[model samples]
Target: MDPSIVREIHQIVPENRVFLDLQERYSYSYDASFGEYLPDIVIQPQSALEISKLVKLANQHRIPVYPRGSATSLSGGSLPVHGGMVLDMSQLKQKCIIDRENLLAIVSPGVTTAEIHRKAEEAGLFYPPDPSSSHISTIGGNLLENSSGPKGLKYGTTKEYVIGLEVVTPTGEIVRTGGKTVKNVTGYDLTRLIVGSEGTLAIVTEAILRLIPKPPARKTMYATFAEFVTSGVAITNILSQGILPAAMEMLDQQCIRAVENFKPIGLPTDAEAMVIIEVDGHPLAVDEEIERCAQVCKEAGATSVHIARDEQERDKIWQARKNVSPALAQVGPTKISEDATVPRNQIPAMMNRLREIREKYQLNLFVFGHAGDGNLHPTIITDKQNKEEMKRVEDAVSEIFEAAISLGGTLSGEHGIGIMKSPYMEMELGEEGLRLMKLIKDAWDPNHILNPGKIFPQPGQTKVVLTDE
Candidate 1:
């Protein structure tokens, strides 16, 4: 960057806020996802006005501005692929107010999701979008990805709770969409548009999130099935019986064995599958619902059903499920996690397809996810350094995407389409559909200076190629 450009940026933001050291720039190079591209400069703007001015400067100089939170994205959502200036949004942590009267949370982009959950619960209110990385990820990242976790089966995603936003548009204009009220149908739903835009549409400075009353009580149960297919049947039966569990998570035998190996939890390693179910509401209703769920699992060929009698027992059951990620990390050097979701009824079919793909590719693939919502995480554990093996892993990944699309599902349920899944955008959304989305991007950022090389595929790119260049 030119010295004049740095001087202009320093004018907008203080000299201390602008990071130009090589080592400092390298820290903002990559995110949780694959690949790394160092930015020319890194800026930490604390206010919306500062960001607005910086964005205007970016447009004037045709520099790509990538707004980033904690960089916990599984997809390459925050990677500075274009190698311009990276705007670290984690420093803008000033606002986080709980509007108890309106049941809303007005928060800054730097506030962690876990903080929001803690504050909401403290006020006797609830925010249900709980991603696995909520403890570390920022609300800005969650809003951009529209991420949700187990509670999403009933409570919905981050997009549902967000009612308004204070955004810096691509053209450096500060705009406010929606308001404190939940019911707003004024015109274009810019709030929804920007919520899941992956920072391609605009930069969010602050957000107003809607909240609901916390549930009074909850019950939990765990069931082990002799066969994976039977576990799917058990899920279908539980839902069919009108017992809408707050969360219905399933794990394959590989996951069970991995967990048992990592930390002995007395889980049935021999069982083909296991599901942990939970229900929340009034005490009596939760008790009855959990019993119904246990009964359905038993009838659906579950080998064992364990109902939690106390909070400790419930936490024990959840602990086994939470151990799956770390346990699987022990299997291989590389973990390619894909969340290919299908229709609720097609979960069984999707499982079958995954089995075939695993056997055909001869790769160590483990499956688990929010079964109640049909979002399965088919993670492939392999060494990326092995060229031949990575080829098979790439093929397996492509097949998983195809299986989900064929079953009338999407390429991603929670993870946004960063560069990793951009190739398959047209496969899921036809050429015309992808074009319409590109049109929206073009209209929002005419200079294409915000988080380029994401969500849209380059010309003639049709498959995922993970091998070295």
Candidate 2:
């Protein structure tokens, strides 16, 4: 960066908030995903005006601006792949107000999702998008990725809750999109557009999120299947019977054994697969629905079904599901997590294909995700340093995407298509569809000054390059 540009940036943000040291720049290089690209500078601007001014400067110089939250993005959404300016949005975390009357929560981008959950619940309300990394992930990242966790089976993704946004455009103008009202049909839905845009179009400074009354009562149960594919059968049967669970999570044999090994939670290691289901509503309705769900699982060939006797037992059941990632992490040094979704009916086929892929690649692969919505997370654990193995891992990932598209599914369910999944966008959307998306990106950021080298693949880049030879 030129000294003149550095001086201009310093003028926008105080010297203390501007970090130019190599150590500070290195800290912002990598995210939770693969690859690392150090940014030229990191700036923690306090206000939207400051960000607007900085973005304008970036556009004038054609410098890439990467807006980052807690860097918990699993898809490399926050990685500064172009090595320009890194905007640490975590510093703008002062505002969080719950508007109970309107059922809305006005919040700053830096606030963690878990804080919103705690505040909403305290106000006798609920904000439902609960990603696994909610405790650490900021609201900005969740909004950008439209991340939703296990509960996404019943509730929708982060895009559904976001009603409005205070955004700094790519070329540097502060603008407001949508409003506090849910039924806003005034113009284009820019709020929805920005929610999952992955920060290419604009930078979100604040957001207005919709909330609902918290569920009063809930029931939890887990069903084990002798065959892994039988778990999918149980899921389809439960949903077909009109029993909508708050969350329907599934884990394969590998995930089961891994969790049991990591923590002796007494999980049924002998079972080939397990499905955890939870339903919430009226007390009587909850009881009836839970029993019905168990019966459906049994009819679908579930080896055993157990309903939690109390909340403690319920948490224990969920703990087994929550322990999956860490448990699998113990299997290898590198973990590649992919969320490929299929239609509910195609889940069995998808699971079969995943099984075949796992065997073909001869890698440590474990599967789990929100079963009700057909969003399956097939994670591969391997040593990236093993060049030969990484080549196989790359091939396996490509096959996973192809299988999903063939089954009328998508390359990503909740995780955004950051650079990690950019190459496959054309495979899923076709040439024209991808071009139309690029048109939107180009129109929004003509200078390409915001979050460059993301979502769109470079020329001749057909597949992810995970290994360097």
Candidate 3:
């Protein structure tokens, strides 16, 4: 970057906030996802006005501005692929006001989702978009990715709760979309458009999130199935019985063994699969729903059904589920996590496809996710340094996406199409559909200076490339 540009940026933000050192820029280079592209500079703007001015400067210089939060994206959403200015939005942590009267949370981009969850619960309310990485991931990133965890099966995703936003557009205009009221049906739903735009459409400085009354009581149960497909059958059975669990998470034998090996929780390693179900509401309703779920699991061929005796046991059960990602991370040097969602009934077939892909590529593949919502994360654990194995991993990932699309599924569920899944966007949305999306992107960011090299695939790019070679 030119010294003049740095001076201009420094004028907009504090000199201390401007990070030009390679050490600081390197920290912002890569996210949780694969690949790394160091940005030319990293700017921590604390206010919307500062960000607006910085964005204007970036647009004037044709520099790509990548707005990043806690960098917990699994799809490389925050990676500075274009190597320009990286806006560290985590510094914008001023506001996190709980509007109890309106059942809303007015928060800045830097606020962690866990903080919101904590405050909401304290206020006798609930904010249900609980991503696995909520403890660290910022609300800005969650809204951009529209992340949803197990509770999404019943409560819905981050976008559903985001009723309003204070955004800095790509053109450097600070604007407000929607409002505190949830019933607003204004002309264009720019809030929804920017919510899942992955920071391409605009940068969110603040947000108004809707909240619901906290459930009075909750019940949890875990069922182990002798056969993997039977576990999927049990899920279908539970849902068919009209029991809408707050969360329905499933783990394959690989994930089961991984969890036990990582930390012994007395989970049956020999079981082909395990399903954890959770329900909340009145105490009587919770008990009845859990019992019906247990009976359904037993009828669906569950080898064992263990209902949590109390809160401690319930947390222990949920802890086992939460340990999945870390446990799988220990399996190999690099973990290629992909959320290829399918229809609820097609889960068994999708699992079969993942198994075949794993065997065919000879890779360490494991499966787990919010099964109630049909979002299954088929992850491949491999060493990226191994060129030969990475080749196979690439092929396997492509096949996984193909399998999902074939089953009337999508390329992603919670994880957005940042760069890893960009090549397959057309495969799922078709050429015309993808073109319309591109039109929207072009209209929003004419200069393409905001979060470039993301979501949209480049010409001649047919598949994801993991290695520089």
Residues 200-281 of candidate 2: C-alpha lDDT, one tens digit per residue: 9999999999999999999999999999878888888888888889999999989999998999887788998999999998
lDDT of 1 by residue, 62-177 (tens): 99999999998888899998898999998896678999999999999999999999999999989999998899999999999999999989999999999999999999999999
**With candidate 2 superimposed using the best TM-score fit, by how many Å does residue 193's alpha carbon deviate from the native?**
0.8
lDDT of 2 at 195: 91
Error of 2 at 362 (Å): 0.5
lDDT by residue for model 3 over 1-469, one digit each (tens)? 8999888887888889999999989999988997899999999999999999999998899999999999989999999998999999978866888898999999999999999999999999999999999999999999999999999999989999999999999999999999999899979898998998899999999999999999999999999998988999889988888889999999999999999999999999999899999999999999999999999999888999999999999999998899999999898889989999999999999998999998899999999998999999998889989999999999999999999999999999999999999999999999999999999989988999999989989989999999879
Give stretches of model 3 more than 4 Å off: none
- Residue-pair clashes per candidate, as listed? 0, 0, 0
Model 2 / residue 220 / CA error / Å: 0.7
Worst 10 residues of 3 by lDDT: 89-98
TM per model?
A: 0.98, 0.99, 0.99
Which residue runs of candidate 1 sit more than 4 Å off their true CA positions? none
Order of quality (TM-score): 3, 2, 1
* TM-score between candidate 2 and the true structure: 0.99
